[model samples]
Target: MRDNTRPLSPHLQVYRPQITSILSILHRMTGVTLALAALLLTYWLASAAYGPEAFGRAQVLLESWFGRLVLFGFTFSLFYHMCNGIRHLGWDMLWGFDMPRLRITGAIVVITSLSLTVLSWLMAYGHVGKL
Candidate 1:
């Protein structure tokens, strides 16, 4: 029983974006990104298990510039997902529902994700000492 007379709901173009909406969308997208990264990780592991020839090919591909870019994006997605998940857990417990707190927490999640991602890359590049 569809109502043909009723107006359709507004699309994305019709709405002003808010922090909560942005974070919510990013959380979902990051989850999917993380899943893809997991498959890449599994492929690398399988290649290693298949011995030198397969492992070398996997390593070579992963060491390329394009691969490094993908890896960097993967790292960012991982941290963002993790931080945002924690925020979600808090919400599940009925916390930070108010607008001000939501804004602060959303900013925190963004900062934490970026910081962790940068730190991870630094360590990977041997820029971080004894850490």
Candidate 2:
């Protein structure tokens, strides 16, 4: 009844990665990233509440190059997660199921997320006019 020669199921190596699959994986990863970022946010807030010295230390760390890099990643992950969630909402409504539309929406999600992240950083650094 069992055949040792045949594979039981398709493995990851059997197929090439597609945009849909990649985006889905990225969405899950970004969700985890956001959760971790929340812990950092909590640390910052707690420092502010603790005292001026604690807050200053927090500020110094946050303003460092490595800190800015982490903050940038957190910002991008936040936007990407939000955009992908909206795409999922459309899916919940029975939309964008076709291959073409799926690709288009996936591209839109990536572009919009990156754009928002960059724009926010620009505004934060006063490179663009404040709202």
Candidate 3:
């Protein structure tokens, strides 16, 4: 009998990654990160439901430097995921199929994600200064 098993496809080391691929991978990773962040949000809500003391401790934790870092990560992941999701929708609609358009949209997603993340943090910190 002849062996009919198909060989596996080439691995990632075979070729350099493109912007589109990087963005696609990041989109998936950010989704996972967002799920973790949701757990954190749930902890906060549960603390509130527990009592004043629990809520105060939770607030203190959330206001700490480590907590701030986690919040920033969560915020960036959310914005990146949202922007990439929109890009995926565009592709579903048969848009941005060409290399140039793909690159442009990839760049746009990165910039928009970063810009929105920064703007959101600024607003959160009340540093937006009357605007």
Candidate 4:
């Protein structure tokens, strides 16, 4: 018996990632990650309902280095998602449908997301440093 498994289609090797393409892909990925993070909120709330120890453990985990990295990623995702979301809404309102404007919007979204992420972390860390 001959088994037939069709080879996959062209991958990243086929097309280089353009700004718009990367931003678009990352927008969806970050949205999914944010949704997962939202579930963590729900989990914590549920833990509080169970007992104090459970909640404390959750808090400890949140305070860990792994947790901090996850939180930072979450923050970055949130800003990226928010910026890209506005771009999507603009499209919904029938604006920036053209290639040039879309590319500009993508660039703006990526830049703003990175800036906001860094600014937010700096603000948070700055306050912590003074204390």
Q: Best candidate, lDDT-wise? A: 2
User: Per TM-score, what order, best first?
Assistant: 1, 2, 3, 4
Among residues 3 or more apart in sequence or in different chains, the pairs in candidate 3 whose N, CA or C atoms overlap within 3 Å are none
Task: State the lDDT at 129 in candidate 3.
Answer: 62
lDDT of 1 by residue, 55-107 (tens): 99998998899999999999999999999999999999999999999999999
Candidate 2 lDDT for residue 105? 93
Q: Candidate 2: lDDT over CA atoms?
A: 0.94
Superposed by TM-score, candidate 1 places the C-alpha of residue 45 at a distance from the truth, in angstroms, of: 0.8
Worst 10 residues of 1 by lDDT: 7-16
Better of 1 and 2 by TM-score: 1
Error of 1 at 64 (Å): 0.6
**Cand. 3 Cα-lDDT:** 0.90
Predicted candidate 4 versus true structure: per-residue lDDT over 1-131, tens digit per residue: 76568657545457788876788789889999999899988988988998999999998998899998998999999999999999999999999989999888988988999999999999999998999
CA lDDT of each prediction against the hidden true structure: 0.92, 0.94, 0.90, 0.90
Error of 2 at 61 (Å): 0.6
Q: Which stretches of candidate 3 lie over 4 Å from their true place?
A: 1-10, 127-131
Better of 2 and 3 by lDDT: 2
Candidate 2: RMSD to truth? 4.4
Supply candidate 3's per-residue lDDT for 93.
97
The TM-score between candidate 1 and the true structure equals 0.87
